[model samples]
Target: MHILALVLVVLPLAASQLIGGPTTVDVNRDDVQQMASFALTQLNTLLGSQNTLVSVVQAKTQVVAGIKYFLTLDIKNGKETQTCTVTVWSRVWLNDKQVTQHACTSRTKRDGLVGATTSVNVTRTVLKMATYAVTTLNGLQGVHNSLDQVISAKTQVVSGTNYFLKIRMSDGSQTQICDVTIWDQPWSYMTQMTHHSCVNAKRRDIGMPGGLFNADINSPDVKNMTNFALGELNRLQGAQNSIIEVISAKTQVVAGMNYFLKIRMSDGSQTQICDVTIWDQPWTHMTQMTHHSCVNAKRRDIGMSGGMLNADVNSPDVKNMANFALGEINGVQNAQNSMVQIISAKTQVVAGMNYILTMRLKEGDKTQICYVKIWSQPWLHRKEMTEHSCSQVTKRAGGLLGGVTNLNVNSGDIKEVAKFAVREINGIQGAQNSLVKVVKAGYQVVGGFTYVLTLSLKDGDKTQLCEVNVWSPAWTMARRLTDHHCTAQTKRQLAAVTDADVNDHFIQMLAHYAVQTINTLDGTHRAYVELISAKTQVVDGTNYFFKIRVRQGTTTQLCDVTFWRQVWMNSMGHVTEHKCATVRRRNVGGVEPAHLSAPLQQAVSFAEDALNGKMNSMFRFVVEKVENISQKASSATTYSFDLHLVSSTCRNNGNSYGKGITDCTPNYGMLQRMTCEVTVEYRPSSSRKYSLAADKCGQIQLV
Candidate 1:
């Protein structure tokens, strides 16, 4: 089976617990803070709620075509503040930013909070609702860690009663406190366990001590035979029942395998303990419930308005439901977590059936434990994954073999391997190439992770590309540089396209993205000035190498940027390689692009005023080149411009901006002498004016 190489998606929700993800970042940082606030802003716009951001609780970042931020934000909703989670994806290069999966942290706050009572008045009806909540919990989970007496309860009345309770719970031995919330309306026979969280969430396998004679309720085979009998029992009584669990069950080989089971079940209002017998003949595909007994129940005919049936996950209809759940979750979840197996399942009869499935999902080389609730009405061809939650299954540190893997270039592990490769190469005896950063990257999974990378190295005064391969067996904690080679890029070469092709929208887009990535990685802040040339190469995926001109405050620089995209492997393909080194030029001229935006034109006009203000020069600005104008602070902007002249004029006697009238003593305000450069900061909010910052102005006169 060919598995898609694009597995660098969101980690399961559970994995994003107190910490965000493997790539956790500080919540206070400007970028992360911006994302958190933006998520709330988008939430306000989409949900039409003016919930302002209170604080960023946590942040998890994934490096895609842009940065994908998984944020936990605290927001002031109204009277009570709520903690919410959201995903914000941003590709600053393409000028695209979006918010997805914006929601409250807990269902209690997320749903039915509008009219829900703030405090609970424990009336007689409230106690009954608590009992109903426990009954439903016992049905879904089985006898294992069965819910018991409710120590306390908080109720929210939204059409139905919602119970948030701290309950006494125990599997077989130790009792623990479980905070569970459920929605119930006895008249409608609707009881759903909305949220379940425990203080000690981890539990050991409750299988019997090393002995074959002891019954193992956790065994799937035992569950299959037990639930099969339960299904038959429900059908017989004309009653819908939910299984608390198969408390104790063992199989015996006779005419067919005989299953003796002790199960816990609930019928809407009360819980029951049942002893059942079943004959399972796998060869004939037949399973029959022989006899059954329940505590304090003389009548074998109990009628429940509507109830849940403990389902053998392997059964035909139940298996179909599980598959339905998988499809729905994968469709909605940005991370494509495919089903590995149905660990357990239960079906509640509603208009059709509601299947609550606990499944094992495969994400990359890891396994995730998922709980998905699906409502599927096949007759109506309607199905939805109602609720989903998954947590990363921690694997013991050891050998993990995988197939051809196309992973995220920005993954923590991927970058670690790339850095290791650089450390290995730079330390090589008499190595001439001093590598700086990873420009482009790809990887394969063999023993551990095999990283294929293109690196930019500082070779004398020029920037060069180096291809390096590193094999790191993460299990063994070892790294090795298997092979390495370097290439000194000569003058710009258009391999697959002519100079005219550089203007192609597709090419220009890639060029712009590459230049953006370089600016982000480069120490000095810069923006794109010109795309001098671009080359495309066809390989397993497309390879784009571009030579672009960028400026950092009054500094002119040339950078070679390489971008690799395997049909959006992880993002707009990842910025595989980026190299930027300032080119020192004397009397260097500037080139102008075809068009500029309105904001950019306004920025230049402001820049002229600032220049004329700072330097007593009537600056008749020659419109040499206008590259880009990007927002710096909330109200400020950074614009890149090429200067033709900045002659100092002592007075502003009604002289329009950019026009120099009188020559000053050449001693006023710093006359920055550089080849050709200018930086403008526009703050229209605070001071409706621009401040001038220039470089290499006096040395190379703009002709």
Candidate 2:
């Protein structure tokens, strides 16, 4: 049966009458013949047999197939044709039995046509699946091309504007859209065509602004898209798989200050855009703000009134406030100077007869300033002046007599002048002779009344003369005479001179009464004389006096003693005074006295008292009294004694034999028995005492 059907369907062409009129068909029309042949070729390929169906033209514009009218082809001539809707139908044959039939219609066309009918062989077709696929691919390519243009334009805009861009796909089933970005240069084609199945199935809406579509080719948006596509291509090149969605970026200014921007993808996910600006000194931003822009949208947010942005900010760490205050204080302290004048002094006497006086000065109550000059003339003279002498003497000497005179006041006061003259006179006198001798003569007014003189005169015409004259005040003259000349000289000669003389003539005379006293005894029952010698010797041809005091017991009976001597060269080669009595007791006792020098009398008195008791105990004596022997040479003396009873009492203390004296016998002993011999010598012609002893005398002593 299938083979009979195939043979009957493969017959040659035949014609049928039209219902309206007889219509001719062009079997070889160029357009009609080509379409018919194409339709038949497709049918044969699909059925795997060349004779799958037979087409018969029953009328001029109608074609019939084995089981159904497959198609009606018409060629019409008109200015404007009616709406023509053409239906296409097909029947399927399996094992020579009809299985099913299908039909499809072409869209109605109302455009004008200018072609005539032609006899054409026709085959019907339900829409071909390969054609639909080809159509879909072509549509995708077209959409991609258009979208690439849009993306390129948007990228250029976005890149120039410092923005980022992305595209996505979505399915409308979920509340949140699932998005897939094409990641190619063009996003619109993927949006419209490649994603059509998802778009159509979900009936999803795509959102992209018309202004974005009109973006400048050179804009940053387009550039961003270009960059996005390039990056995605690089990511997908090896694996060809990657997810695309929202893109994100961040920017910061200061730590807490910055700008943020967000863009939403088609899937309702968001991207962040950030820009950072760091602010230091002299910071500046390149973009300018305009009136139309929001505060954050402005290129530079500085100098605006309403936001948290600040321009020309300053730091609080480096302000200098204290230095200005110190400058003011220093300016006031440089203007004050009145506390600086002398306070007290201490002094010490140094060598060269000068005194060192230190005067302390003060700045205030507590500060001591040293090295100030405070003392005046008199104190200066007492303190610092050296003792000196003027070699030249006054022509007319004799003003105030010898105490201290010739007080030549040059620049100093009375005290200074007096001190100067006293020291001068003393120095001159001391250079000539012993100061003791010069003071002995007392003060003499000489060389007229203009000068005072101190004379040191020797017995042989050697004289040391010091002349002092005061041209001014008398007190100065008196001070010079007393302090330096008479006062010092008297002190030096104090042992030799009497207190009377010292009080009457020397300055500071009260000092003499304190000297130690000397004692003496007289065997002749008369007062003994005291002589005090000077420690120093006189110069050549000079004379010195020994001071004398005659006392009876504790009473000073008389002081009327003079010192006189005969000048003689002694055997010891020294010229000293020879013996003679120069002073005597004024009242006399009844006994006639042997004439002896006062020195000899004093020596005799000393020996008598010292030996009196011992001698009396050793010898027995009657009523005969002791006396000075006479009737001999003036330098020699002899004694005689008469003994009457030869008694044991006359023995010398039971050790020797001697004649005893009766009541009327004279108590004179032999001159040899009463005297012992002694000789004293000294070298260099000085007076010093040496001791002499008697052999077997059992301690004979000399003074």
TM-score of each: 0.22, 0.14
The lDDT values for all models are 0.57, 0.24
Candidate 2 structure, TM-score to reference: 0.14
Q: Model 1: runs farther than 4 Å from truth?
A: 1-508, 519-524, 574-579, 585-620, 623-703
Model 2, 541-660: lDDT tens digits are 123333333333233422322222111111112213322233332321222112444433333333332333234232332212223322222222322211111112332332232222
Q: Which candidate's TM-score is highest? A: 1
Q: Lowest summed lDDT over 10 consecutive residues: which window, candidate 1?
A: 205-214
**Model 2 lowest lDDT segment of ten:** 311-320
Query: RMSD of candidate 1 to the true fold?
Result: 31.3
